[model samples]
Target: MPSKIQKLEPDRTTIAIGLEGSANKLGVGIIRHHPRPDKSSPKPPAEILANIRHTYITPPGEGFLPRDTAKHHRSFVVKLVRQALKQSGVSIADIDCVCFTQGPGMGAPLQSVAIAARTISLMWDKPLVGVNHCVGHIEMGREITGATNPVVLYVSGGNTQVIAYSHQRYRIFGETLDIAVGNCLDRFARTLHIPNDPSPGYNIEQLARKGKHYVELPYTVKGMDVSMSGILAYIDGVANDIFGGKPKYTDDGAEITREDLCFSLQETIFAMLVEITERAMAHVGSQQVLIVGGVGCNERLQQMMGMMARDRGGAVYATDERFCIDNGIMIAHAGLLAYETGYRTELEDSVCTQRFRTDEVFLAWRDD
Candidate 1:
């Protein structure tokens, strides 16, 4: 329970600073807006003022290691913060509130973000708001697609789950019991000895596109949960067939080709997701479907969801890398909305957590 929603004049001059530290990416944003009454009340919502997003990519071989990620975050956060503020044309002194991710991410990365926000909040005398990272991703997707109450599929390197809004909170309908989908993709890329350039996920997708023949990748599903470890093993076993020793194009055997494996893998994985999403939509009574998080940028994934939505007479939505792939703007957008809801975190309450389930966040930031 927090402050009661109160009515105020149509505000045209309010700005909020947002900090996102859920993953290795340390993002910061500033948003300007006009103030308004309770969004859930009879009053309408406020207008946005200014918005910004910044992401600091972790150096190679440092993404999953928490200690190394901490160093990366601490080193680049201050500069990024100033850059986001400068780009938004907003002053830290005038920032009405500060927000940062509190959990559902690496503990070291979370601590890095929390410490930065807490330090700034104390120095600026601004109230701090702690937000759930996954929730931020979902809200950002909603803003990008204008999809309300859609079945949300959150897929990232560290997390993968199917979710939908219910009872004033996002409820997890299905998730991986052991490993995430993105993690599997990255590991598969490693098995194929693909250059981990740009992004491993993208690299795998490209190789999959050139591949031909159904590689018969494993597909394991129990109820609503999926296990991709078997699929990874199967793909590794067929690596030699999919990727040849020389770089030259050699069409030798029709039994297995890179394009076929890639196509089959993408189709199988996407079908699993689509199956669960359709089930979740049926259960939630929602027609809209939204894809968010880092993996949401995959065109193949989006296409699968699009086909699923069309089959169900629904609509599928997703944001590009701008909002979908772990950025500062989404964090800031979600933070601004939560701040308007009268949600702020005291310094003592702002502790970084290794595990914060998405469904656990209450109605503090939601509107009826």
Candidate 2:
């Protein structure tokens, strides 16, 4: 870590442009951080000039593939960047740095966006900042909700973790041992042949709302970690049985429907998540909890988490879809924070990986 911090004059503002294509969604964002009025004053909220995203949707029952997603990103990255700059009313010269997701995602999509970031960095002669995808979600959640040092529960298609900031790092207290919760839900939706438009998880949530009976499913919680693969497999078998003309009944002898299965799966998995998150909060002696990542946009999860937080005499913080889902603004915000601390990714070191851990990032901007 560099000992020198980048300081700005009171009248100066820091600007950054970020690109994100870690999965199916390709996004571009521009943001500005105004200088603080004084050293003792609180940091002002970030001003989002433009936050644009375009997701590559597959047909029903299909998930996004790395190559296809990368192709989609290459097709739209430049356009989105131009639109973001136009919407923000800022020129390339005004941007202090270019940020992009560095890792913990699909290889092709990460590389596609990285190439764009590097091009922008060279074309505009701005510094490059490589941001961890998970860190982007955490910092964006904190900024949007104004939650100061709360326990973070990051849930997405590829990740599920309970994290807390400590010793200049976001340490993981718990995580999924198998597939992530969102992955389970998404795969279950595919099993049901549900539409992927607007997200399969959202469709499942809608179906779950109409379910009157809850079928039993596996609940796997091991110590501080949770497992969803068993539950997914079991539920998938049940769904297949129903589709194969084998009638499945609930405890009340009512025949199980797809909606009922969706309901049961969601309830069981969310309960497991709540249990572990509560345990983490208890261990850390923190009442406040912040939920981030794409799955954090689920209203049912938010409601369940909120209920658990209230029971602990605390509160739950979550953002809407725009910020909750993967977006470039988060990359810009987190990278700019690092850039303000004299952090930069040299051209030779500007590489993206497929398996970057959240704790690998050193939080130079944070003291706690």
Candidate 3:
């Protein structure tokens, strides 16, 4: 042979997928990166084989009941999973692991994703990995912003916590003792007679900007834990006064309107998060703060955190909606780290749990 050119193998490969189906949304994601393909092959250029994330929103309206949402999740999983894999340009046989969120969600919905992943893993002869939903949020925050050991303020429909990572676990320095932040926002929006369509929260956020007064809302915080249910009751009382032939909103068309209520609600909730997070920073003795979760996507909340960060000489990092909200990428990214760390779940693993602690996952299983 006069000359021979060696063919090079790709340095990167995708070995895992992260699936999140906690509620009304189903996130399917595939993460890929390059390293030495095998011991015989030298590491090539750093590359991302594929990092794909897709979301399937539950089609039903705001008051999406659990049963219907679960049904939606089941129906959409087949399509979304296929789409994610296809978009990633990864064949089913190439996936080394299938990771799915295991619990802390509606049982029917959680089981739907778990069963789907199980079916795929069994068919493809790959290992199954179950992740924690909350930890997924945290890790996604880290991956997006490159923040490590920052105080975490996670606010969402089901969770509101000021957290710190310590001893291989996320510690809850503070958390919601009552109704979640997003739930309060939605319920308050309903009381304002706002349309449930097109996302009541965004609509409320729009209307809130038009508001210019502080209508007092209760602030409940006890040793880093807060309650919002009573605030809802009290706000409902105010709104009922306006509706019960009193004097507000309905009296003069748009004057003194729902916008005021929305603005006040946002201010109240955002302030609570800021206060608790600030307190946690002091408690943890760390100046860096990372804000993650759906509620963290709120502009007003970001502004509030920004203010606190300035006060403490600390920087606050927030994920764009891409990673902030429940999405497949976060799950995939988190799951990849878990899988690489050798965390795998057996098919016999349980499907449903009411409250699964995030730190309890022994293998990093990647928070679902």
Judged by TM-score, which candidate is best?
A: 2
- Give the TM-scores of the predictions, in the order they appear: 0.87, 0.97, 0.86
Compose the digit string of candidate 1's lDDT tens values, residues 59-87. Answer: 34334477777777898888887887777
**What does each candidate score in C-alpha RMSD?**
3.7, 1.5, 7.4
TM-score for model 2? 0.97
Error of model 1, residue 215, in angstroms: 0.8
Clashes of each: 15, 0, 5
Candidate 2 vs 3: which has more lDDT: 2
Off-target runs (Cα >4 Å) in candidate 3 are: 1-12, 35-62, 249-255, 363-368
Error of 1 at 10 (Å): 6.7
User: TM-score of predicted model 1?
Assistant: 0.87
What C-alpha lDDT do the candidate models reach, one value each? 0.74, 0.92, 0.73
Mind giving the per-residue lDDT tens digits that candidate 3 earns over 85-164? 77778887777678788766667778887888888888888777677788888877876676757899987777788888
List where candidate 1 sits over 4 angstroms from the true fold. 1-13, 36-63, 240-252, 255-260
